[model samples]
Target: MTIKPIIIIPDPLLRQVSKPVERVDSDLTHLIDDMLDTMYDAPGIGLAAVQVAVPRRLLVIDVSKEGEDKQPLVFINPEIIRSSEDRSVYEEGCLSIPDYYAEVERPATVTVKHLDRLGKEQLTEADGLLATCLQHEIDHLNGVLFIDHISRLKREMVIKKFSKAAKSKVTV
Candidate 1:
């Protein structure tokens, strides 16, 4: 397992919609491992495949607080089958977006369907932080970022800031 460098904003790939995984195999599993490792190393609760430069409808999440058993989840070709009308807000951050974070309002509950790590079908209903995390990562599969939920001016400013930061890092 290895932590791959996250693809940051202004990278066009993050905006491109990810293709669904057609088959689960050793390769896909390895990607899952890498994603898990990356997310943990990121010290993040969730990560999307696009953040790692893999344009696949894949994501890894583990929201268990420290000291709890690590609960890793892999979602392959996941789609939200249901979502509650009630909304909740969370201050969300992305590894791809580095330190920037913003409050994003999303469904308070969601039912998602996907294939698990062992190639088994799994469906889960999540609420609260789990619900927000699920929706945030799912947005990545659709080429949308949490920042997109913010105002247009805010989004543009964030993108420009990140783009400039990226350039500075490149030249340094």
Candidate 2:
């Protein structure tokens, strides 16, 4: 599987809402494989298709700790069906945002409905890091970023920083 280039902040594509996956074919399967490869290569727990400039409602995640067996998960057209009122905070990072991280509060548990790798419908009840990762990636599908959960001042500062870096790369 190929490791795709991850699009960073200030890239308009990263803000684009992803389209739902209509079917699971060989091409879709290949994309899933590539996404998993890309996520692992990024050394990140989760990744969304939009982060790779693919406007598809797909995401890959592996929240396993180092040295443990990798447990990769694929979610297509994922939607949060239910979420606990209980809240939790995690220092969240995104591949698209690179090194930036922020404490984001979200539901402690979530029930997500999505299509499995085989296109079969599945509902996953997730908690802890898994729940946070799922929520983060699913937010990407809707053109939302983890920074959006932070204060507006901090979010703007991050966007400005990345925007300047992106400009330098273009001029260089």
Candidate 3:
């Protein structure tokens, strides 16, 4: 498995909605392995295909605590089937956005339906950090970023900061 390069913010491709996976094949499985490798290498709890410049409705997550056994999960064409009205706030971060983090409020519990690596349909009821991570990664599949959940002013500031950083790298 190869660790793919994660595309940082200010990249237009990150805003593009991902396409659904057509079928589960060897190539798709290979990509899943690579995604898992990339996510682990990133030292992040979750990652979306778009973060690696792949416009596919796929995401990998491992919300296990540090030093505990990893419980990697793959979601293809994931959709939130149900969400509780109860709200919860969690400090969220994304690999695409690097070190930036913000407390985002969302449903305390969520039921997501998606295809597994074998293409079998599965429904997962998630809560706590798992729910937050699933929501965050699923948002990526729809071309949404965690920052989009924050205030307008803060979102613009973050965009401007990353835009400036991207420009500096080009000139250097």
Candidate 4:
């Protein structure tokens, strides 16, 4: 598997809705492998296909704690089937929006349906960090960012910061 370069914020592609994968073939499996590699390399808990400029409904996540064996998860064409009425807040960060973090509130529990890397249909019930990470990555698939959940002032500020950094050719 190869580590793909993650597309940063201010890239218009990040705002585009990802297309669904029609078939789960070797090529798609290979892409999943690359995504996992990229996510691990970024040392992030979750990553979406759009983040790597693939523009497909795919994501990889590993919410395992540091020093624990990594538990990698792959989601293709994932759909949130259920979400609890209860809410939880977490300080979330995204690889696309590097070095910036904000507290976002979402459902405390969620159940998602998706195709596994092996092409089998799967449903996952997640809570805590896993639930938050899943929701965040899925947002990328829908052309939404965590900042969208924050206040408009903060969102604009973040976009401005990233836009300026991009224009100045400075790493964010």
Candidate 5:
């Protein structure tokens, strides 16, 4: 597996809604492996395919703490089947957004249905950090970012910052 370059903020691709994966074939599995490599290299807890410039409904996450055994999960065409009424707040960050983080509120628990890496249908119930991570990544599938959940002023500030950074990168 190779570590793919993650697309940063202000990239229009990040706003594109990802298409569902038709099949979890070998190629798709390989993409998952690459995503895992990229996520680990980014040292992030979760990553979505759209963040890597692949407009597909795929994501990989490993919430394991440092020095602990890695527990990677692949979600293909994931759909949030259920969400708890209780709400929780988590300071969320994205691999695409880099150094910036903000508190976002979402359901404390959720049930997701998706295809596993091996092409098997799977349903997983998640709460706590896992639930937050799932919701964050799922937002990417819908062309939404955690920043979108924040106040418009703050969201515009973040977008402006990234936009400036992107401009500087191009000139350099």
Candidate 6:
């Protein structure tokens, strides 16, 4: 597996809704592997295919702490099937939006259905950081961002800041 380049903020691709995977074929399996590699290299708990400019309903997450046995999970065409009414706020960050984080309120628990890496169907209930991570990555599949959960003023400010930073880097 190879680490792929992650798409950053202000990329229109990030705003595009990802298409569902038609089949769990070899290419899709390779994509899942590459996504895992990219997420681990990014040192992030979760990643979505859109972050890699693939625009497919694919995601990988590993919430294990350092030195612990890693438990990587791949979600293909995953969807939130249920969520608790209780809300919780977590300071959320995205791999595409580097060095930026803000508190975002969402359901505290969620039940999701998806295809595992081995092409097997799976369902799981998640809470805490896992729930936050799942919602954040699922937003990517729907062309949404955690920043979108924040106030409009803050969201635009972040977009502009990233935009300026991107411009400066390109100019250099």
Question: How high a TM-score does candidate 3 get?
Answer: 0.98
Candidate 5, residue 69: how far the Cα is off, in Å: 0.6
Candidate 5 residue-wise lDDT, 1-172, digit = tens: 8999999889989899999999878888889999999999988999999998899999999999889999999999999999999999999998899899999999999999999998789999999999999999999999999999999999999999999988888853
Q: Score every model by TM-score.
A: 0.96, 0.98, 0.98, 0.97, 0.97, 0.96
**Top candidate by lDDT:** 4
Model 2 lDDT tens row, 12-130: 88788899999999999999999999989888999999998899999999999999999999999999999999999999998899899899999999999999999999999999999
Q: What lDDT does model 6 reach?
A: 0.94
Q: lDDT score, residue 110, model 2?
A: 100
Query: How far out, in Å, is residue 70 in model 4?
Result: 1.2
Q: Each candidate: how many clashes?
A: 0, 0, 0, 0, 0, 0
- Look at candidate 1 and tell me the lDDT of residue 4: 93
Number of clashes found in candidate 3: 0
**Backbone clashes in model 5, listed as residue pairs:** none
Better of 1 and 3 by TM-score: 3
Tell me how far candidate 3 lies from the true structure as C-alpha RMSD in angstroms. Answer: 0.9
Each model's Cα RMSD: 1.3, 0.9, 0.9, 2.1, 1.0, 1.2
Q: Least lDDT summed over 10 consecutive residues: which range in candidate 2? A: 163-172
- Over 1-172, each residue of candidate 1 has an lDDT whose tens digit, in order, gives 8889988889999898999898999999999999999899988999999999999999999999999999998889889999999999999998888899999899899999998888789999999999999999999999999999999999999999988988888853
lDDT of each: 0.92, 0.94, 0.94, 0.95, 0.94, 0.94
**Residue pair clashes in candidate 6:** none
Which window of 10 residues has the lowest lDDT sum in candidate 5?
163-172
Candidate 3 clashes between residue pairs 3 or more apart in a chain or in different chains: none
